[model samples]
Target: MSLSRQTTSRRRFLQGTAAAGAAAFVAPAANRAFALQSPNERPVFATIGLRNQGWGITNKSFKFADFAALADVDSNVLGANVEKAAAKQKKKPDAYKDYREILDRKDIDAVMIATPDHWHTKISVEAMYAGKDVYCEKPLTLTIAEGKLIEKVVKETGRVFQVGTMQRTESGQRFLQAIALVKAGRIGTVKKVTCGIGGMVASPVIPVAEVPKEIDWDFWLGPAPKVDYRALPEMRQGYGGGVPLYSNCHYSFRNWHEYSGGKLTDWGAHHVDIACWALGASDTGPSKITPLEYSLPVEYKDGNPVVHDQYNTATSFKIRVDMPNDVEMIINSAGDNGILFEGTEGRFFVNRGKIVGAPVEALKENPLPEGAIEEVYGGPVSENHTANFIDAMKSRKQPISDVWSHNRMLEICHLSNIAMRLDRELKWDPAKREIVGDDQANSFLSREDRKGYEINM
Candidate 1:
């Protein structure tokens, strides 16, 4: 049968009552059965953390499969999402404050996790243990240790995991074609890669106020140190809130040390992952990180700038990381958020929707190495980011951004943060997964979980 005809047949079969049984019987051989099943036989997925980017991921997944449930700590966000999903799916979904409730249901074949960075490890590891595949948001973990832990669970459980670094799946022909060229060696020997990522600083702190009746403050604060809930008025800074609740929920989580690794991990999760991919260093990372310079943002406590927050994280900074084979990656906090690849033949730069070259027209004439980038990027090119997760779930194959690779890239982001914190150059042993010669810096690689929240190996 033709590909389109097979897709249609799968869709029809998936919509019927026997869809689950059909999927169970056919998924083991999904690639082979691709031509036989209707396109409707898509898998079912549940979404945890329904605020901010979580909402966008849900909409993307709906085109491929039924959105089985929505879970979140905030009732305000949860109820609104449930209604929206009901309208879209034509059925009210199960809603719960505790993600464990959703994980208990066998009907949920997979989960899309966009929780706070701290919670990413816990929820994802648990989901995999629960026999569910995961599509987790970027930065993957709150710390280097957690990244390694999640990587372990994923390997052992054999569950498919796709880090939500959607840039890997973006469709802009220029950027896609540029990365293709870099991998193809059109840029020649990659001597350096510079990534620029920064935006407005954290908002001034406000006093702690009553927790919204619609939100569960304790659950939202999951695993992080307890702090007074700040009632700062929401700022209008674009992508999610300019600041997250407790200064860690919204866009501002990039600024705090407790819940995130600031921009080092926030934007690093996106750009750095791509850089590593283009360099074919997904399984490894830079051998050394030196914080050339830094300027931290002012700290705020109870709506006032305190000395403590003066430089919680480096707001303006530059770090030079030494990759294998004498390749050096210079990352700077400047310009809009994007990456620039400086190669021997020429230099190529790419941000969200734009790609430009030093010679300007090199991109138009230089073709990618025959089957280079495509070989590394396995599977359908058109699958929406979330759809890739579902495809991996059924096929039990690694998605474009797997846990092992993402964790390796995350180490670069984590080490940068550590180097800035210590104000010193750091030596790293990737095989040992430790910072060499510095006990204090090495200690920062992991954190002590509050009692029951500790990650168990």
Candidate 2:
């Protein structure tokens, strides 16, 4: 992480980004539409949602950009982050509970939105509209429609958007190496890829509790439909968790369908995204999704789960997806949690920690060319994901984890969850981006946003 020298003033930062936005959409990623300030002259940034990932990213953010302001609906977390930011350097950022206020600031060149899955798309779209570049955490959207909305926004605004699928720039480059090997035909014609992303567990019915005083409960539940506020265990920094209560607040939001698609989006957002990249199908999606076996925590009617008090996502499941070009893929709970890529010649498994298999073991004797892995990354390896985003901002280039491809990968995860919820097989047309002959299933492509929080392209 680079230390800030307080080089560029707030006023100059706003002027550069505003001038850049005027001609942003007119240029390509390879073209420089703005005159980027030098590394010594830091670009201004404001981080929204100072939770775990957001907190960690904010720490790394100072390396590349200035922290002009910080925002989170939780006032407790907001103040803590402001103190942490001030401790790192002399800059004292204004703090706010509403993230929109931070986005409204013209001096903010970019914002890292680490909000819950439900809020990712909305904040990202608004941030882009505010002429601020966005670095949003993964499972970038809650539904296919939201992905499309974000896609339209990114293309229209040409903002530097980087999804927090950081494995693409991990130190070992294990994922990139695996993708490179697959693309280089080191593994013969691709046969089938298995992504072992486990399902969510069933949580006992959680009783509603009074909202915390330090948090703005309404703002936190922005696009998600109204639900009773439940008290949750605070997640301590070093210790694992604060308590074992199961309710849709903070970290546990990942386990509920109302807020997120459970682990299908949690871990799936990472591995499945990598699986699609390896298959060279990032621009397209699966044509058919078959739920082989699944167990839900509750019963359902008309696709909405009947029991809402308990966790409703699938607790146990396996899904088979048929991608374009006859490639077979499975997202399930059967194996170790990682992506397994099998080709006619060799097979390998990769995750955030490691990439290993018979083909990889063979590398001890016959290694892949040095150029192969770098080619997968599109160039040399980056210092970190945040660095890549900042570099992209400077060069006006697309980051490794670009939006269109990530959204296409997310389509598969969303379809997998739909098939699991319905417990059936469904055919899809990636070209049309819809379920074929199944209106009910097609409707699952998007969800009804709360009255005031609809997303429009």
Candidate 3:
């Protein structure tokens, strides 16, 4: 649908459903069929990067978006996902090895970006400048400077952007309830928040191998430094299996510092974002980041890994972050994989599975005020992360996981990795968004893209 027509239809649907507010609170996903009304009113979408998460986000959004195109560097993966997506949506979408084709199509109202961490900023910025909304995966940018660039482009284009932090809107609304509890003073004067994001395992030296004929290796390595493709013969066996067990590509990209920030950005992106939101520090950031304990997979000198054949990110780590209001935030690879919030009056533990504590139990008798979750969410929460993105696209407003707030919290995760690599404590000036008096550490905030692939502003 055209942007103007989509907006008019959305407004009318929302007005007609105003009486269903009570039902919406019970099952927001059902009430969120506002975009499912007529064929001409449905929004158009296309997906970039058709790997595991690329397909995951696209599959869930099939109910709300009519996908028109799909792009990926791997021809095999691209072909497979296009068939699956077409079957689900009952329409065939054009396939392309290059994502720019999708961005150039004026009919595409928005683009869902699930590219590896390294490629996020380039594609997102270009898509916005091309006049399309964006729904990019979390750990929004590869570096702090990249995040700033994305935020700038979003403001300049006035496009709706959403990060794939579903915990804020989905997960049975467990995370939303947790935030509402904190706002209700159920956890009075929050003292500390712990985020156990888990860790990665060390990989043996992976031998350099010939690039797959079916994949465009150069395009896949866009912006990242040129390197020989490395892989192991033993194929990975489970959920994210079929790809090389230890390669500088596929799912293993998260284990490399060159492409991703290890577990710190992998899972920390989700948990730390929630921790910051509950503490009312989403707009600000930590004052200090200290790597209390860490174990790297390989030797390092001057913050750069000595070897390149194996994974180089930290295998295990425990970081301390000093937040506002004297809140001591701990991010570690131990304990439960969730956020544990403690306060002076009471405490609570929340993860994807459940939310439990004395305060959560007390909710049976002394419940929180009506519309508490909505207030914490800034407005009525949508069905899921993508639904929220579409809702924002219609209203021409920022989604719940806006770029400004996401970058603020993500700086903590990025700083944690920096502190671990340097093996020391680093002071931060949040307002300035820089490391205090440490030029070397500050240098890691941004990286130059490879020649011929720089972002086309």
Candidate of highest lDDT: 3
After superposition, candidate 1 runs with Cα above 4 Å error: 1-40, 171-175, 234-238, 241-248, 298-311, 358-360, 363-366, 369-373, 455-457
Off by over 4 Å in 2: 1-40, 232-240, 455-457
Q: Global lDDT of each model?
A: 0.73, 0.79, 0.87
**Alpha-carbon RMSD of each model:** 6.5, 5.5, 3.5
| Per-model tally of clashing residue pairs | 16, 0, 0
Model 2 lDDT on a 0 to 1 scale: 0.79
Clashes of 2: 0
- Model 2 scores a TM of 0.90
Encode model 1's per-residue lDDT on 192-281: one tens digit a residue. 888887733544544556676777877777778676565555554656653433344454555677778778887888888888877888
**137-201 in candidate 3: lDDT tens per residue?**
98898899999999899888788899998878777778889988887888898999999999889
TM-score order, best first, reads 3, 2, 1
lDDT of 1 at 338: 85
Best first by lDDT, ranked? 3, 2, 1
In angstroms, the error of model 1 at 294 is: 1.0
Q: For candidate 2, lDDT tens digit of each residue in 262-346? A: 8788888888888899888999888898988888888988778987777787788888889867889988876788889998998
